[model samples]
Target: MALTTDRPITTAGLAAQRQPERNRNVGRTLRRLPGYAAVALLLVVVTYPLIWLFLGSFKTQDEFLNNPTTSLPDSFTNFANYSQAWSSVATYLQNSLLTVLPSLALIIAFGTAAGFALEVLVWKGRQTTLMLFLAGIMIPGQMILLPLFTVYFQLHLTGTLWPLIITYTATGLPLTVFMMATYFRAIPKSVFEAATMDGASIIRSFISIGFPMMRNSVLTIALVQFFFLWNDLLIALTFTTDDAQRTVQVGLLNFTGQFGVVEYGPTFAAICINVLLILAIYIFLNQRVMRGLAAGAVKG
Candidate 1:
């Protein structure tokens, strides 16, 4: 039926308009259910473990193990375990930061520079160089450990911070170069050409143009690499024999002597502290990195 009139809408017009409302209701119900369910599931997964850790941090050793199935301490207990762990934690953490911070800076600076040079600057045997660089990434970290140890021993470098710092920087290169290369490949070629035409030399072009564009990816890589080196246990354990030079992971790990009498309270507390520390570093730097990425700073 067709009804045409140059008049205001009647009941049929009202019904026609209401039909869209019905469809919208159906569509929204279908969409909202899955979205809410997924959100709920994610919240539980993230919050439960964090809450458990928080609660257990305050409980007594006996209370923690026995009542952990049911609940944590009724009151906060003023975070006493954190102070208890602080004695060893402070020194080891200082050692970790010292090694990790310098290694991280060298990795980012040298690695990004290496990647840019390899990709953009033409020279003899560039392919061979890249392949050789890639060759290291393929070798298992453990396989190189013993040989590296021999070299370190020969250099009289065992039982000190220098060995770990140098080793962390060396191992970090392969992956850092890989990450920088991937991002560099994605930048537009025109930007590099423009910078070159404007008379910006190689170093200036990279600093003024290329490095800005890949900031986000670089920060992400830095975060991942920093945490990787920071949490490393094996290499640090081997190279660090001086009581004061041991990294936090090596020191904390040594706490649990093959017998599983886990200093669970301190362990959980340290875990929480590590999470917060990493989060703080990323949060502070990620904003600036994102801004640099948004500026489209391309690398040659």
Candidate 2:
């Protein structure tokens, strides 16, 4: 005789037991449907314009003008517009790099140093100095533009790139300093104390230890300032009168004329170039940016 349980083993019984679990899985998926749909819709809304821009970049002037904006180009091999746009914007792009790179370097170096001294060093008036930087953040850039131009004019620096660099550095520094100081404050003081006992100078400790740990914060600041300087039109236009000193943002204006004439193909190509570069950089550094933001959030 075989040993048997009180209930008989049957497919119907097994199916009956599993039915509630299957229903629960279905309910969970149904509950998440709205969020999935929302994300998909948002992605399309953001990506559709970029798709249009890329397609338009390949079109000739005649094709772009005659065809519907939604239509694809007849040829993707057209490089004429890109060649033309590059030639037109090359000088401006060079000037932009010159202005942005130097400005960013100064901002990072000075901001980090100042923040370290304020937050890490035990010095008199440290709090007062931090407060001053905080106050600088509230001052409107527009209010000081006329005065800055006047001073630049007086110093005979109006035509050069120096004014743009100096203005960008100055305007960018306060926020950088504030954020850096905030980051530095969260670091334990005993770490520096131990290094001091080991015969390490403040500069040596900062270089070897302090600054290295700030990689995420520094990257975050760099990206923020990079985008700002890259996209800025007002400051670039105001400070630069000569075409030689104009940045890429201002250079884009050259594609338009007084009579409403536009070079659609080359304009789209130039814009696509900028968009693609920015996207590439963002994608590359996006992980670091996310980590930096998460660190800041948790640290606070």
**Per-model RMSD to reference:** 4.2, 2.0
Best by lDDT: 2
Tens-digit per-residue lDDT, 124-203, candidate 2: 99999999999999999899899999999999999899999999999999999988888888789999999999999999
Off by over 4 Å in 1: 1-16, 186-201, 207-209, 212-217, 256-261, 286-300
lDDT of 1 by residue, 1-300 (tens): 998778888999999999999999999999899999999999999998888877777776777667745575766865767876677778988999999999999999998888788776678987787888898799788888889889999998887788898989999998888767767767666788888998989999889877776677778778879889988999998888877888888877765423667777777676677667877887888876675454434543
lDDT of each: 0.80, 0.91
Model 2: runs farther than 4 Å from truth? 1-8, 257-260
Q: State candidate 2's TM-score.
A: 0.93
